[model samples]
Target: MKNQTKMWLLIIISIFSSLIIFIAASFIMGDFGNKGYDIGDLKTISNEVLTTIDQQEKGISSILDAAHAEHPAVHFEWIQADGTAIYNTAGTPQNYDFQQLADHFLSIPYNLWTEGETISLVYKTHLQQQPYYLLMKLPSTAMQPGQVYFFLRTTKVLLTLLLPLIIAFMVPYLLAIWFFSRMNRRIHKLNHALTQVNLQKDIIVLQDTSKDEIGQLTQHYNSMVERIQSQVIEIEQFDNKRKQLLSNLSHDLRTPLTMILGYAETIRNGLYKDDRELQSSAKIILQRSRYMDKLLDQLLDITRQNTHALTLQLAPHNISEMLRKILADYLLFLDGQDYIVDVHIEDTDIMIHIDVALMERAIRNIIDNALRYGKEGHYLGIILKEQQNDVWITIKDKGPGIASAEQERIFERFYRVHQGRQGDGLGIGLSIVQEIVDLHQASIHVTSVPYEETLFQIRLPKKEDELN
Candidate 1:
């Protein structure tokens, strides 16, 4: 996968990991929460029932006392142990049969009726219709979970156990996510900008004003970018210097090779062979030798320009006037050439700051290449055009356009595409032009449509743009 895609995957995984930890912790702690204290409705109802039981026991005693004191004639009743009537206040024979009463009394448990202890019941038969109060022995058995009285409340305990754990885990997990979510988005924006930076495209810098770890990271990232830009500038300068040295050396070597070839070809063809012809050949040989010396000198000058501090002999001069004068000097050598030349500058006298001699050599090398290679009647022209704020001095040729794959390499030294021809070139002209353009802070771009049009478009800052 690409570096960009891998970075996004890491960021997404971080968020999910935080969420997963929260869920697992919540599940483990949920079992221990205490909710039973809040479900107290059953205790309230049991207390009210106990109060009713106490009132019923007291009312039973009041009725028993009334039967013994005043209802003696109405077949008054009395309870006794061992199946006997201890007292009958009524004159009539026993109203409740003793055998039937003792059996009925033994059936009702004593715990259901009284709190502590109970005496025998005293009630007349007419007054005892409201209740059959039991006079019996109490059993001492206790109640527990399995018996009918026990119903453990599980619902109340469960609710009390789970709520706070849900809250305890949820708040921190959400807080962590909310905190990181904003930082994550900013990092994503910065990642996009950094990827675009490698493509030589413009980037929008990330803005994070928060005082946090993410903010510090952004600041460091920006500082790293600044350092990288400085390093790139230094590396490019060294590269250009290296290419320049090779180009000059190759260009210098070409003259002697050209002479050597010309002499060998002339001797083979058996051209006129007098002492003057011999002298002419010798003269050409000597001239090429000296040309090598001048090439070395030019190479030294380029090295000086790059290594030492630059001292521009800045002056305001018209670009068109200078080009015309340089073209006039080249008229003798180019008089018989078949190439077409056109000049269409917007201003004849727009003064700008430049080193005039250096600028002329850069422009002249371009025209010289055109004359040498405008073979088989191909046309070459120079046009100067302007748009908005900049002026372009474009030199175009309809000769074989430089191939799409070879355009970038053209500015490198000693890199000859049209190989094995020494008089033709050593590939220094374009390299020199590129260096001068860099020094001037102007831009150069070469674009070509194969089998159609090839252009070397040089954009120069206008008079107003040049500040010395």
Candidate 2:
């Protein structure tokens, strides 16, 4: 249930429970108040007073005194018909006329007057045939019949006004204690988890399965922790890759630089035997310089890709013709290299949007990787075909292919399949290939088996209108 609804329900239950307790307490108090005496005892006392008077065994004063002794909570008075007090337990003289008081008592039903703080019952009787008045005054607390009824009526009026007021104040107070206690517990858990996270620098998750507001807060907190952990891991991996890049660059550049320095020194010192040797040394120097320059260019390209600074000039081009041209260029370079170049290009009129320069660079990098690593197999296969709305370019080579474990990391900067192998070129070639393909919004995947066919496939979306 919703939090608001649950709060309201708690209030309602608290009020109901409070009412039940109040009513029960009121009943107990009422019953306790009425415990001492009742109308039956009063009637019995009055009858005994009459019998004593009729027997003439004792005077009216003596009789009243005896009754007073029997029920001390009651006040007894004997008055003549003329309002003269003949016997009185209280010494105070009557301020009002006895006849009026008697008349008031007689006017009430059952000749019993119950009001205010006291209950007065008047009895008319004859002593020696002479009319006298016997007044029995019982305090309201004595639990006389009329007094009980009066107290209950007054209590009803008081409770009617007071009970709702009490319930109204009590319910929210109780609800506040309950709500705060509940919230404090959940907040404490959250705080404790946060403390652990801060101290340990590790993920700390709270176990809260409730679907309340606090539960949702907990879920969001857990999600945030997960994101933080993932970012931390990503940062560590990036740092490692950066260190690897610097190490590889230092080694690769040093070798070419050292060669160029040595060759220049040899020519400068006139250590060469003839013009042919001098020309060979100059040429070697030039080749090494070009290789170092190419490595530096690759590094710049990767940096631009990482910073999202590389822009693509997109235009639709025939993928079949593009693949054939790339293949012809590679074949010219391959010339007499003992490698089988199997080419299959399905002539398709459809074109795909691409950055021609970046795409060719990507394709050339893949073919170069194959030629370098797959030299032992001496076999290279290139295929271009259209399948549905996508153009697939598959470049397969029979070489000691990548391991399943290393395939995922092959595209990472400076990650080489054959580590510590000199002249393998910086391993950023395939990484740059991946970045270019991603810019074109295409996908690339590689599948390989040891010394078997290693296929690199690039899938590019066919032109939208052509697909339609």
Candidate 3:
């Protein structure tokens, strides 16, 4: 669920980033386009104004001829066309080049431009909108003929360009907002799922079962939840077994000790004084006392592992040298027995952090278990291998392999896998081996295949941190 939320967030942010780039670029391009059109309109209107004025030449001639015929001696003339002007409402001629003024005026509808020498304010309502300027050339006989003609207008050009620019701004802006909202909705849904996950509560099953990438991700998350549920169930089962084993321990050993204590009190303090009676009572007392001592010792070693009395002093030491010394110590005790001990080890530098005495006791118990439970003529084998960062030790034998159902409980205290072969000592040897390995955080595994081999393997990490 957390993963899904992160994916949706990334997608949403990417879409928003693209939308911002698209809108910015579109705005710039639209403005540039409008600017180009405005420049063209100015130039085209300049040419049209010139045409309007040139068509007036014949009219100007008719008016000038009538004035000259009426007053024959009046002197008047028009010559070299320099420029023009148009007057505002304030009766001032618009200043600048004649062509520029003509372009500015010609853009207005129903407006006319003509070359003239006089400045005057003219109102023409025939234009679609009242223009900023309207210019006309005076007759050749008019006053101030020294001035050329010019005109100016701005209203029509602005209205022509305004509508399209507004459309350009709105269309893509609306679409970008629409796309961003869509991606935001997807991300919000995914975030809700992750909120449930962070609280360590049950997940809400997403109902959007569409066949897209989101659907695939939802399916994977559901599978992870199922696997986690199964592991939790396994842990509960182990906890229940641990409780059952503790209950069994109290029942099994207390019953035998009660009888042994009762009988010992009867013989002590002159209760059995005859020679034959004394001898038999002494033997019974000695045997029962030894049995009780062994049971108490086994329980005490594991239960108070941190007590100063039981805790072994740990030090750094070479593992190969220690194992060789342990092997020599075991050899003299098994001199007469036909059982063979095969040791396979590498001649490499493998050092470890451990209590030498406790380690020796742990390995001896494993060897004893093999010898006591193995089938006819099967020898015990110990193989040790080391890599740069770890060591693996394997103990194998052709024992009557433990049943599949008993493999897990076989490591519990007093769990006897083979009932017929359980007479030598309490069934806590493998338990001790497991406890020691657990104390060091090393790993242990057991596997038994029918009629082939039974193996106990231990894996220990390489000692890397030096004692400081």
Candidate 4:
């Protein structure tokens, strides 16, 4: 059910349960409740007093006096059948102001006015030998017979019956209200937290102190914030990288373009009289053009990688054979150069799912990086290992290893490790490699120590069923 629906359902159930409990407890306790001056009991007492007066032939005053002593809150008056006053306890009039009594009687609704100031009865049987009317006058307190009458008569029984019914109805109702009130406060807190979120600043995570639906909502909100924060950071980094790439492109192109322009102008303006000088100028111009073309190609590669337009041709293939061939190609390219290639493979037929061309390009970048930067060490090692449900390719070099602080930025486009290094290529090979690896759902990590050794490890997932 929806949370709001469930909340209301529970509240309704609590109220219904409280009502049921109140009714059930009241019925169960009724027998034990106070029987305070029941109308029937009062009538029986009055008949007994009348009998006593008839048998003794004593005046009605004596019997009324005794009844009055027994219940001080009540008084008695007798009136003859002919409307003559026989006896009155007050010794004056009936002591109840007729106008005031009539007004009080009229003020109350007829259905609600059960017992009032006077309870009168007429005696016409032979036991009295004459017709008479007995009028009972009750105190102001007993004039209204309600719960208070029972309390004034018997406290214990009345309390026992009332306490449980009152508690049953009120306690659950109050608790349900309290629970919903707490939920309301938490919802408001969540709303405030959401309203206050600012993208320009770090994300704020709301506190989820409860183990309820509200807490779950807060947790999901926090997770969404974390994902957005990560995307924002990635976008900012890409923006910074783009700015740096343009700056480097401008600086790198300036020298070569200047050389090409100056030499061409010299040849065009006939500034070089000697044939040899003219040939030299043309060769320099040609060389600068080639360098510029190569720089443009690298820039294109970076653009393609950053824009995520590289399509992958995924297939299952032997990774070990692929590595060996890649190494062989590198060896041929760097033939006779001061370099060494060492290879290790645990299995020659270990198959993996990959985009062959992209994976090859990724591995080629690592090897090219080793050959270029590790020229001083003159040694490179490639290790391929198959583990349970996974495979790893590690390339190690013993050149002037990267500094600890620069390792994290090594994969950034156009990021040069040594700013003063002699180079004609843009620093985007590793970045492209990282992009391809990410496309394959793979992970790469690098460990390097200055002047010691650098290791780059790439991990890829493998399934035994696919291999079989």
**TM-score list, all predictions:** 0.43, 0.65, 0.44, 0.57
Off by over 4 Å in 4: 1-170, 272-283, 315-354, 377-398, 412-416, 419-427, 438-468
RMSD to native, candidate 2: 11.7
Best by the lDDT measure: 2
Worst 10 residues of 2 by lDDT: 144-153
Per-residue lDDT tens digits for candidate 3, residues 123-215, read: 221223322233333222322212222243777777667678667756765676666576556657766775676324555655566566766
Best by TM-score: 2
Clashes of each: 2, 0, 10, 0
Q: Go through the candidates in order and give the C-alpha RMSD of each one to the true structure.
A: 15.9, 11.7, 13.2, 12.7
Cα deviation at 60, candidate 3, in Å, is: 25
Q: Residues 170-204, candidate 2: write the lDDT tens digits.
A: 77777787876788689778878877764238789
lDDT comparison, 1 vs 2, better candidate: 2
Q: For residues 1-468, what per-residue lDDT tens digits would candidate 1 score against the true structure?
A: 854455556556755775687777765554344212111322342233334434564443344345335422122233433334434333332445666665544533343233443223222221223333222221112111121132448878766666776677567656756655655677777777677675254444667777787788878777777777777776777677567546546655865868767976786687847879877876776777666765665566556545753445556678778866766776665577754556566654666677787677778877766656644335666776665667677877777777888888887654555764544444556777777777777888988765456778778776645633
**Clashes by residue pair, model 4:** none
